[model samples]
Target chain A: MADAAISVQGARKVYSTPGKPKRTAVSNVSIQVESGTIHGLLGPNGAGKTTTLKMLLGLVRPTGGTFEVLGMDSTRPSGRRRVGFLPEQPYFPVNLTARQAMRFYGSLGGVDAARIPERTTALLARVGLADAERTELSKFSRGMLQRLGIAQALLGDPEVVILDEPASGLDPVGQRDVRNLMLELRDRGVTVLLSSHQLSEVEAVCDQVTILNRGSVAAEGDINALLNVDGRTSVRAMNMAELPPQVVSVAEEIAVSGGMWVFSMPTEQTRAVVDAIDEAGGTIAAITPKRESLDDYFAALLAAHTEDVAS
Target chain B: MMKRIWPIATAVMMDSLRRKVVYVVLGFAALLVLAIPSLPDYGLGVESAVFREVALALSYVTGLVVVLSLAANRVPAELEKRTVYNVLAKGVSRWEYLVGTWLGILGVMAGAIVAFTAIEMVVGYFTYGELMWRLWEGALATWFEMGVVSAFAVAVSSVTGPVVVVTAALAALFIGHSRSTLLGGEGAMALRPFYPSLDAFNVVNPVAHGSGVPLVYMLSMVVVFVGFAGACLSVGVLLLSRRDL
Candidate 1:
């Protein structure tokens, strides 16, 4: 059998509200995540990223099509046991200590009672909450609560971890810590499905990405492949005015900053620009190629999708 | 499956135990039941009469408290805190969750009922120089009545807001108390033409008769009320499971 961790085929969800026309949250969406890969689901607010995650977790029944997780039906208990989830906003019983919450979740996952305490302690320490083990959840800060959320999601060491906006309310250091954790999990050969509006975080940790727009998949592929702009090169020179007319005409756009001329070049002619600049005696200060970051790529995809919808 | 349900029930119990409303309501019920002895001297009635009235009133008050608190917090708290999403994502079916919560709330309500009954019994002992067996029977009937009311509140909470739930449950309680009259010969004869099942109203609407208390009678009543509660709770769980949370 193929080792795809998740396989969604033409899945769709429609929410019916009283006195209003039904709203389609996910529209005939199909995607797949292979085993041992970090997959990022990227979309703007209300673009069905969360909806898709919910469907994969079997929290919502799909109106059309089907999805499988870990080679079993998403709704089956055996399949769910191999998955862990972190919701966008997670809350715990106010009186439960961090350690108690872990043990509670662990027990629900059918961990042996004798092993739960030791495992809970180890998990709490791994999540950097060992010091706060005895603290009541009611007293936790937003960042602390998020850490607890992570701990609960990792309680059973699930094969597929799904997180929705895990870094939404974290500080820079907290975000970095979470990013490192995702990388660590990926290194351990766990499949990750994360949805986030923060493109930088996705770029830093995700191996593959799927961008959703207006309830449909707009783009999906390996992150590097999706973000690589093939025909783009950048050059910096001491002065653009001193360059030969032919060399300047070949430049797509040019600007002088910090006593250097920055040039954008078509990918096929970048070597020619370098040769022309060196020959023009315009002493090249720095030569670098510019590739689209995930943020830029997602923004452009969303803009194109919006334009398509509008037209 | 039972293992999964037990943790959910424990979580709900712990969550409800931490709410300040529970503490306040329970404290007030205890004080009210304790003050029954002093009411007779305040010209309310003779000592035994006062104890009976006070025990009945305490039962009604505690039942109302249970219905209001459980109904008010059931769905709203889950949605407000977003914890429902976490558990639901774990493949815990929504029906299982609702049933677990109902069991948890029922445990708390049972505790409250016991506490209030103990206070009333103590007062009865002090005022009459002996425990009233009738009062114990009344307490049993009150428990059944409260169970029915609690189930009704949970059903309302599945589909309506807290305010509406409390209102509808209280109205049901009052209507149930008049069920005896509603199922009487005159009532049945008048309504039988339109509704063939007019006689079945007594099954859903059980009214407690406090005149005499017997263990066998109260036990049978409890069985009947439990059946009603079970049906209502099943409907409640089904409705909640189908809802878009």
Candidate 2:
């Protein structure tokens, strides 16, 4: 925990209106992100993913919690000096050109005046906005603005970056760029806490994930640990006219297409299945542990939680 | 602290330059100042005094319109657009944000007032054939008063929209200048000193009809400006700190 780059413990946010019932936006949500790793925060709409990030960034006052970054309380300015945040659908002063906006945010991030222009140019080019440096933000497309948001968030070369829906308004290519950027940041030993709805993006880059449902952590921990199906092995074989009878008896899910057979069987049955395929003059193309897709895992987790609430 | 505050302030200043409100208001006020000498009731006996009075009034109105336009909308617009998220998330304290915003509006006001006053000085000089240096004194008072007004508007805007902020600011202005009229009774007079009034910034009598405001009085106006603006901004920071962006 001491080595964690970002730590949020028992975070809570309750909003009260004069004549309405108190609303809880977040409830006892805790997250620990280790240094130099990508941690994905996934949730459906209104699941408090953004709220948790806001609390961590001190943009929203938490009802109760201790948020820390690099062993300092994150709710204070000093603690956030080394952190960078990109809000969901990040907005900037539209009247400013891209270069001017970068200078403004860079200065706020405490970038040295002498280095700001150099850093701004480098960061803008890095985000694929070098050509638009002098273009006013009002003329920027949503995707361009998203890219600029990313550039500004990196102005200080932050040690820990918190991004909420960084790919919200991006195209497929831009989304790919963002995913690769996260990987690059992790490679540079920068910690990332990403709140996103793009499950594929998260699955591709995240080492760990926390799934929030209804303002609570419905599931968390290692991605593989949660998705890998225990005692099951997936097998793919080529040039098989049909699955061997012995293999078919044990294979739970079996399919054959274009002389390629794909099936899942108990891990203990792998040796027998291989032997049958070899005896049947079939090539063993690949054998790996069966795993659930993140999309499926997320849906099932939410469905079970809904059932729990309903019951 | 200045590092963070200065950037936000400069951003607001830069944004103000792009807005048309300042130019429109200043242009209209300049035209009015030019036309003041052509008033139907213009007389030869006290022409300079009358011109000074009307020019100062024009300056005040122009300053009010420009300040209200900027202060009322700056914070609310930023909040609505979520542009403030980037600033605050960069480790800027709420007080710094509010102060920087107010300071920027004040800076614009300073430029406008100086320009407008210089125009009045030129017009007054050509018409009366004497340098109406006293208009600078009026300009100083007007600028100080507008600074206070902008602080109030910026403070209110931290919690509400532009409409509420403008309405509240206008009401504060009326009450500020109407303290004696509103509090007429003996008992009310007892509470006069504690009342938040802006009369200390009013120097029309001295600058328009008599010798220019004394240096001591001008210094006192500075104190009043600082005190009122600081109090209002302190309240704004408190409100913004408690708010969830």
Predicted model with the maximum DockQ: 2
Q: Write the per-residue lDDT of candidate 2 for residues B1-245, one digit (tens) a residue.
A: 99998887788888998899889999999999999989877666788899999999999999999999999999999899999999988988889999999999999999999999999999988998989998999999999999999999999999999999999999999999998898988878888988899999889989889998999999999999999999999999999999999
Clashes of 2: 0
Question: What are the runs in model 1 whose C-alpha is more than 4 Å off?
Answer: A75-79, A231-290, B40-50, B185-219
Candidate 2: docking tier: high
User: Per-prediction DockQ scores?
Assistant: 0.41, 0.89
Candidate 1 lDDT by residue in tens digits, A43-103: 8888888888777776666778778888788854457877888998778776889988887
Off by over 4 Å in 2: none
Query: What are the per-residue Cα lDDT tens digits for candidate 1 across B79-179?
Result: 66777776766667666677777777777777777777777778777867766556555555666666677777777687777888888876776666654
What TM-score results for chain B in every one of the models? 0.80, 0.98
User: Which lDDT tens digits does candidate 2 get at residues A1-311?
Assistant: 43899999999999998999999999889999999999999999999999998888888999999999998998998889899888899999888999999999999999998999999999999889999999999999999999999999999899999999999999998899999999999999999999999999999999899999889899999898889999999999998788889998999878888888889999998899999999999999999999999999999999999999789
TM-score of chain A of 2: 0.97
